[model samples]
Target: MSAELAVVYAALILQDDQIEITSDKLQTLVKAAGIEVEPVWFSLYAKALAGQDLKALLLNVGAPGAGGAAAATGASGAAASTEAAVEEAVEEKEESDDDMGFGLFD
Candidate 1:
C-alpha cells in the first residue's frame, strides 16, 4: 500500500479502538503492521482528525433517508423505464418501410 494510505488505515484502526488519535499511536500501529511510512503522514493525519468524531462522520456518509433500499428501488425503476424507451425506439425503427432506398428483393 502507499505510505499515505497506510497512514489513513492506521488512523482508522486507532479510531476503531476508541483510542485518542495521535502521531505516536498512528506510527505505532503502522509499524506494528510492518508498514514503513514517512513520519509526516502520521503527524498530518493525526492533526487533521484530532477533534473530529470519525465514527459519526463515517456513519453520516450516505443517503440521508430510507437508506440503501430506496436508492436501489430508484435505480431499478430508472433502468426499467430506460429499457422500455430503448425497446420502443428499436421497434419503431424496425417497422419503418422507408429502408433508405434498399429493399429485401433488390
Candidate 2:
C-alpha cells in the first residue's frame, strides 16, 4: 500500500482502540504492521486531530445538519418539478407524433 494510505490505516486503528492519536503511536502501529510511512504523515494526522473526538467525527460522517436537510429538500423539489416538465414535454411530443397520420404498416 501507499505510504499515505498506510498512515491513514494506522490512524484509524489508533482511533478504533480509543487511543489518543499521536505521532509516536501512529509510527508504532505502522511499524508493527510492517508498513512504511513517512514521518511527516504521522505528525500531520496527529496534530490535525488533536483535541478532537474521533468517534463522533466517524459516526457523523456524511450526516447532514438542519440547513443541509433544508437544502436537500429544496433540491428534491426542484428535481421533481424539472422531471414533471420533461415528462409533460415528452407526452406532448408523443401525442403530436400520433396525430401526424404516419404508421409503419401504412
Candidate 3:
C-alpha cells in the first residue's frame, strides 16, 4: 500500500477473481494513503454499494488492519469455500475424463 493508498478507502465487488472497485476507492486511492477521509468517502461508498451485493451485507472497516472488514467476511464468506469445492470437483471430472480417453480426438 502506497502512502496514497493508506488513507483512501477501497471496496471491491468481486465475482470470481475479477474485481470492480467502487468510485470512492478510486478517489481514496488517488489521494495519499493515511490521509483522513472526508464525508465524500461515505457518500460515494453508499452510492457504489447501493442496489448491489452490499445491500445484503453489513460492512464495517473500523479495524486498524487491512481494509477488508472482518464483519463482511463472516458467514457470508462461507460461499467462497464452495467455490474451492467446485473447482476441486471440476478437476476431478477432468482427471476422470483423461483416464477414460474422452479427450482423444477421433
Query: Number of clashes in model 2?
Result: 0
Instruction: In angstroms, give how far residue 42 of model 2 lies from its true place.
Output: 0.7
Instruction: List the global CA lDDT of all models.
Output: 0.82, 0.82, 0.52
**What TM-score does model 1 achieve against the real structure?**
0.56
- Window of ten residues with lowest summed lDDT in model 2: 62-71
Q: Would you give me the overall lDDT of model 1?
A: 0.82
Question: Residue 71: error of model 3 in Å?
Answer: 14
What TM-score against the true fold does each predicted structure earn?
Answer: 0.56, 0.56, 0.27
How do the residues 41-104 of candidate 3 rate in per-residue lDDT, one tens digit apiece?
Answer: 5456646565555423445333423445544666556467657889999999888889887864
Query: Which predicted model would earn the best TM-score?
Result: 2
Flag regions of model 2 displaced more than 4 Å: 65-106
RMSD score of candidate 2 (Å): 8.0
Using lDDT as the yardstick, the better of models 2 and 3 is 2
Q: Candidate 3: misplaced stretches above 4 Å?
A: 1-73, 104-106
For model 1, state the Cα shift of residue 16 in Å: 1.3
Predicted candidate 1 versus true structure: per-residue lDDT over 1-106, tens digit per residue: 9898888888788889899999999899899989998888888998899999898778877644545655676887857866898999987776674466654555
